[model samples]
Target: FPQRYAHSLFVLRYRTLALKELQVASRKGARNLCSVLVKTIAEQVWAMEHPQYTESRKEPVDGSMVGIQMGKTKVFLRSRAFQQLESLRNAKMIDAAILVQSRMRVFIARSIYICVCSSI
Candidate 1:
């Protein structure tokens, strides 16, 4: 169930990319492909900020900026792409919501998000 929900969100997240990778075939088609690239990027960043969380008491994704560490592949390091993908996977939450219903829920969610952001 979670996997299917994630796939749907991924489809939504990169609907154009998945389409382009499978169907896009011309210069005009490529234009829309760019939109997917851009949106995927933006969503990736947004998802990073709002990662998957649960109501359980298990250890959560650290909510602090401490112990932060990042690096790339070098003579003794790692690949940049690999690191970025890892970060995105850890951040881009595509199936965080288990149940979604009604416009009011949507409105309140968005409102809270905005309120939190404004506070920052």
Candidate 2:
């Protein structure tokens, strides 16, 4: 197919024409592609700017007052937030109805319940 690159390695000879075709394809649906890529980038940016989309940030360890302390980023990323969310999803704890609730309320209620339940 013309759509496929002649070679996966993309040699220089093919690079020019390949780039030209990509440019043509990109131009044909630049708006759509831009919208998609822009959406992806926006989501990534949002995730980067606020890593707590699925959950809120928990209390961070204070380095000055602790025997051992970890940076917020380390704690945030390593937090059980994702795993807990995955389990909630697997357990079907919240279907579509609960998903529409106010973000803060939902998070607070769900997190408290999860924390209490997990402790047992």
Candidate 3:
């Protein structure tokens, strides 16, 4: 199924990134950092692969939801933590939040459109 394929790609991409980070940590002689990063990455990948299903589950699950306007097709303002992480990840090289937000908006919109079309 398309969902399964998408999930696989997501896992692959993250796994590749994690491996690269691990290598960097090792080269920097930060054994503790490498160990912690690998553990966290493994946990995240497992969580994504085996999502919990429960009747008590509510909409807009924490950490998983990325807000975007449906009609206007824009990203809702991100939290402070997200902004900080984005900046940190980019090494302050450029403030590309607008570009990233636009991409997120388009991706979210396209996903919604696909789900709507598929269910019809």
Candidate 4:
């Protein structure tokens, strides 16, 4: 029982650290993906800690609002930085599109293009 308790505490601490890393990455201009991932992970952790709430599978709007407010207070990511990251993401998307189109043209005879750009 003591070993299990220690393991649980270690897991919780690891998750807390992972969340902090995600917040830092988001502030460093990984806006959309990082923020969404962080929120989902946080909600999941909250649900796990509160088993009673798990049965409902519904997040309280006020709870989320409060969480958002708390997150804002803890980490401030400037709008300009977010916009810059967005622009970079957009550019990568455009490049991916171009690559896909080129691959399509090349594989036109085969009628199938399997170009996969993993860096989104």
Query: For candidate 4, lDDT tens digit of each residue in 1-120?
Result: 111112223223223324555555554543343344435444544554465866776643332332321243132223432343345446656887999999888787454333343333
Q: Comparing candidate 3 with candidate 4, which one achieves the higher TM-score?
A: 4
Question: What stretches of model 4 exceed 4 Å from their correct place?
Answer: 1-76, 109-120
Please provide, for model 1 over 23-99, each residue's C-alpha lDDT reduced to its tens digit, 9 standing for 90 to 100.
44334444444334433444333344446632332443321121221212111112432344345544434333323
lDDT of candidate model 2 versus the reference:
0.36
TM-score of each: 0.24, 0.23, 0.25, 0.31
User: Which candidate gets the maximum lDDT versus the true structure?
Assistant: 4
Cα lDDT tens digits, model 2, 1-120, are 112111222222122322334454465453333333223323333344466652563443232221111232121212233333234344443554466566768789999999999999
User: What ranges in model 1 sit over 4 Å off?
Assistant: 1-28, 52-120
Candidate 3 lDDT, tens digit per residue, 10-119? 33323343555655555554334433343444344334434674334444233223221111211222354234334434543344576788899999999999999999
Model 3 misplaced regions, further than 4 Å: 1-29, 53-120
- Cα error, residue 20 of model 4, in Å, equals 19
Cα deviation in Å at residue 117, candidate 2? Answer: 62
112 Cα displacement, candidate 3 (Å): 34
Clashing pairs in 3: none
What TM-score, to 2 decimals, does candidate 3 have?
A: 0.25
